[model samples]
Every structure is written in structure tokens, then in C-alpha cells.
Target: MTRLMDQEQENLWDSVQILSQINAEKAKAVFKVTIEKSLQQLGITVPVFSTIRLSVPSTDRLSQLRQIEKKMREAYAHQEKEKAYEYLVDYIERLSQMTEDDPLVVRKKLLASLLNERYKRKPKWSAKRYRLSASLSPLLSKQVAAAYYTTSEVAKKLGLSDQTIRRMCEKGKFPGAYKTDGGHWRIPRKIFITTPEQDERAEEALQQIDIKNQKAGYVDEFDL
Candidate 1:
């Protein structure tokens, strides 16, 4: 009996380590199976564990700004100059609203100002730039107010239904969870499970954003 318990404990620890390495979607599937098997092996009839809670620090709004910049890059790559300009203008507007003292935002705003000036000086550069910006004004105004995980995202990670996550949030089961001004539940990333790969991808994307920003003649303080 002692040996069996020891082996099960070891297996449980290994399973947790694996969970921390994989993406949330994949981890949910593995979590259910592993927990159940581990319990059965220990001769437990009832499930002992409920939800797997993992905490990661919350990312700033700059991450979303970086994502919008990537979309702009993709648009330009596809020769969608109109779409790219729309994304650029939207990106600038978001930067303007950010209250953080991030120096990167200042550099990006400068680059965007330069790009906007180029557009005015050379209308032939993108004939649809003004027209699309005007048409997309309403859409651009509907920005995501905060950086948070949706109920569905939390639900998948916790192996619960979306409704259940919503209920839990309402009952204050999740610390740091709150409803947006629009009345939608927003779960902070700090209370959410995150994988190392996700963090690596976010870091890579920020590095790319910085490189692109620097190419526009704004040098980083570190580079100086």
C-alpha cells in the first residue's frame, strides 16, 4: 500500500509538470484523463481533486497593441494597403489611450505620425487609405476595453462549462475576476493557467514589434 501511494504521488507530480509545458486547450484533455487514472490506481472511488489552479502574471495592454501591429504587417504583406492603413490608424488611437509610462508607446506613436505624414504627402502611395479609414471609424472605436480571458477560455482551462465559469465568477470563486463596463465577465490572466510556449510566443511577438518599430527610425534607450 505504501509503495502504491508513493508511485501515484510521483505520477501526479509528473502529470503537473507536463500540464505546465503544454497549451491550455491540450492541457484540459490531459488533465481530465491523468487525474482520473491516477485516482483509480490509488483505489480511490471518488475524485479528490476539483479544478487545477495555476497563476501567471497579467500582461499589459501593450501585448494587444503588438497583436494589432502584426495584423498590420500581414495586411501589408498581402498588398492590402487599405487594410494596413486602417490597422495603423487604429493602433495609434489605442496607443494614445494607454495610460502606462511605456517608452515603447512613445516610439510607436512617433512612427505612426511619420507614416500618417507620408500618406498625406503621397496620396498615390495608398489611394484607399482615407476612404477605408473613414468607413472603418465605427469598427475601430469598438476596441476591447481590457486584456482578459473570456468565460469560454476559463471554462476550457478548468474543464468546466462556460455557464459554470460564469456562475463561479459571479459567486466570487475566482479572485481578480470582474465584469467589464459592458457587463461581460473578464477573467484576469493572473488567475488563469498559462504554458511556457505561450509566454515564449508573446515574447517573440514583442521582439518583432520592437524591431519593426526601430526600423522606422526610433531607437531604443538600450540600443543607445
Candidate 2:
């Protein structure tokens, strides 16, 4: 399997280079064959190919196609083979509609939205509120006003690691995290617990600080 993967990578790399040099029809042929061979090498069946209708030959179009390829590589790089293979097929089909005028920015947003839809566990209203606020500012009518923080922030407050927080999200234990446009996870503040132990700890710390300050007559310097 390792050897097959190596060969597939080589083929894909060679095909990418060749795609830039060849005519559109030839490039398409090479790409299709490479995809097919790669799928076969992995003991997977290739789905029906989607034909890209290129209206123009330009660097911008080439770049979009390449971006699609990059997305495919990134998606499959660490995923289960069966799932990765399936996603790649869908990605290639989407790539076929490349036009020089089609905005890469919009394309990327569309791709992210699609990918998120595919893997999303469920709608998280609280996470949605934070994300919508950050992106749209004024807030969409659909957004609920819920306090959201990142996993890191939540982890710090809860005395947990970001990984543990993420596991909570996956398990539907955490209320929900909104993945920001920039891909940062946002946790709803409403879901956070300020336990009695936390309050006790905070109070203890304040008491210690107060005691130290009193000996030095630093009462004016302290707020608590």
C-alpha cells in the first residue's frame, strides 16, 4: 500500500506539471487517468468523472484548478482512506466548472461551507451567535445572542486542554463551537460552568493577596 501511494503521488505530481504545459483536452485526459489510477491503486472504485467546462485558458483558471487539487490533498492527507477517496471524487467534479472570472475567494467559501456541511454534527445556536457576530458584525437575524469563546479560552477557564474541549464538542457535551471564517473554534459562554470550586479558589486567591497587601499597608493599591 505504501508503494502504491508513493507511485500515486508521483503520478499526480507529474500530471500537475504536464497539465500546465498541455492543451486543455490533453490535460483533462491526464488528470482523469491519474485520478482513476490513484483510486484503483488504493483498492477503490473511481466514481464517474465530471467534465470541467473551461471557457478560457488563463493562469487564473489554472490556479483555481490547482487550488482544487490542493484542497483535495489537504482533505485526504490524514483522513480515513475510504472517506478521503469519496471526498476527492466530489472535489474533482466541483473543480470542472472553473472559469477565470469565478472568484477564488467565493469558491473557497463555498468549499468550506460544503465541507462543514458534510462533517457537521449538528446546528449549535450559541456557537452560531459568536461566529455570526464576528463575521457579519451587525449580526444576522438568524443568530442568537450567546456568549462564545474559543476552546483555548474555555479550556483555561475549565482547567482542561483544548483537545478535551474538542472531544466535548464532538460528543455533543459542549453546547457547540462555531468555526470562524478563519477556522478558530468558538465556544458559547452560556455553556461554561463557574463551579463552586472555581469560586472558592478565586476567593482564596483574593484572601491571600489581601493578607499580603495589608502587612505592607498596600490597601490603596488593591481593588478587591
Candidate 3:
């Protein structure tokens, strides 16, 4: 009977040790993931420290993109539409060269679409602008085009005057509202007139994009 009890005690101790080891391993994995995510947010990738080596190249590309986007925003703030458009063209050209299957390419394409929309109603819309917008259209999904509403379109939709819509947008009544270089307001359709089904679809789309982005070794959190 004493031998039997000793054997049972040994088995219990072994199980306890196994459980403790598993918990420790899990904690280490969680810590590594947390560190990796924090570094990614800062646009830093240390391949030697991370198991996700594939992310290093993409992260470098994203850093380059962020610099270009910064220049574009600066140009926009200074009311230099032409300069901003030039930067946008450069940005899209770089994204086009990346593999189409890349999730980053899709996200960047949507951003490029938004930037392209800003110049659509330019008073001095040039042939160059038209060509650039046209070339970029094929690269973007139709959903991106459907996501924004022009000031006049919103006015018509809400049965309000265009001036009223612009005033509301400027007063922060509209979420995701942005002014174009031509001083026109563009509103996000999702925030303005989306039905529950539309909202669900949009959420699902974003979740799918997130999943694909994760598989691609990065998460997209940057905006123009």
C-alpha cells in the first residue's frame, strides 16, 4: 500500500510540473507577441528578435509609405493640390509595383482612392489629373468608390441644401468628413446613411482584411 501511494504521488507531481511548464511557455509566447505588436506600431521590425521575419520587408515598405503620406498631407494643408496629387501619383505607382496578392496593396489602394477623390472636383482639373485618376481606378475596388459621398450627393440624399450639408460637415456633425483641395466636403457613406446590413457588411469586409493582413505578417493602422 505504501508503494502504491508513492507511485500515485510521483504521477501527481509529474502532472503538476507539466502544467507549470505549459503555462510558462504560454506566458513567454504571449510576451513575445506583445513585444512584436508594440514594435510594429512604431514601424520597427527586428527580425532577429521576432519569429515573423517576413514582416521586416513589409514594415520597411510601410515606413517609406508613411513618409510619402506625410509629404502629401503637408502639401494638402498648404493648399498645394497639384503637389499633393504628384505625391499621390508617386505613392500609387509604388503600391502598383508590389504584388497584387498582398493585403497591404489592397489597403494602400483604398487610401489612394480616397486621395484621388479629393481632386475629382478641382476647378482646374487638368488632363494629367484625369489620366491619373483613371489609371488608379482599375487598381481599387468598387466598394472604395461607394464609400464616400460628395457634398452635393449628401445634400440630395438628406433633402437639405448643399450649403447646409457643408456647414454641418464643417461643424463636425459628420464623422470621417474631410475637405478636398477645392474646399469641398467629402463624407463617409458608412457614417452618414448606412443601414444595419451595410454596416455589418463593412465590418465583415474590414475583419477579412485584418485576417489577410495578419497572415501577411502585419496589421494596418496608418491613415492618410
Best of the two (2, 3) by lDDT:
2
Whichever of 1 and 3 has more TM-score, that candidate is 3
Score residue 18 of candidate 3 by CA lDDT. Answer: 28
Q: Is candidate 1 or candidate 3 better by lDDT?
A: 1
Task: Give candidate 1 regions above 4 Å deviation.
Answer: 1-146, 193-224
Q: Against the correct fold, how does model 2 do in TM-score?
A: 0.29
TM-score of each: 0.27, 0.29, 0.29
For model 3, the local distance difference test gives 0.44
Clashing residue pairs found in predicted model 1: none
- lDDT accuracy of residue 28 in candidate 1: 38
Candidate numbers, best TM-score first, in rank order: 2, 3, 1
Which pairs of residues collide in candidate 3?
none
Alpha-carbon local distance difference test for all models? 0.45, 0.47, 0.44
Best by lDDT: 2
lDDT tens digits by residue: candidate 2, 97-130: 5433354543454455445534657654444444
Which residue ranges in model 3 land beyond 4 Å of their true spot?
Answer: 1-57, 98-224
C-alpha positional error of residue 84 in candidate 2 after TM-score superposition, expressed in Å = 3.5
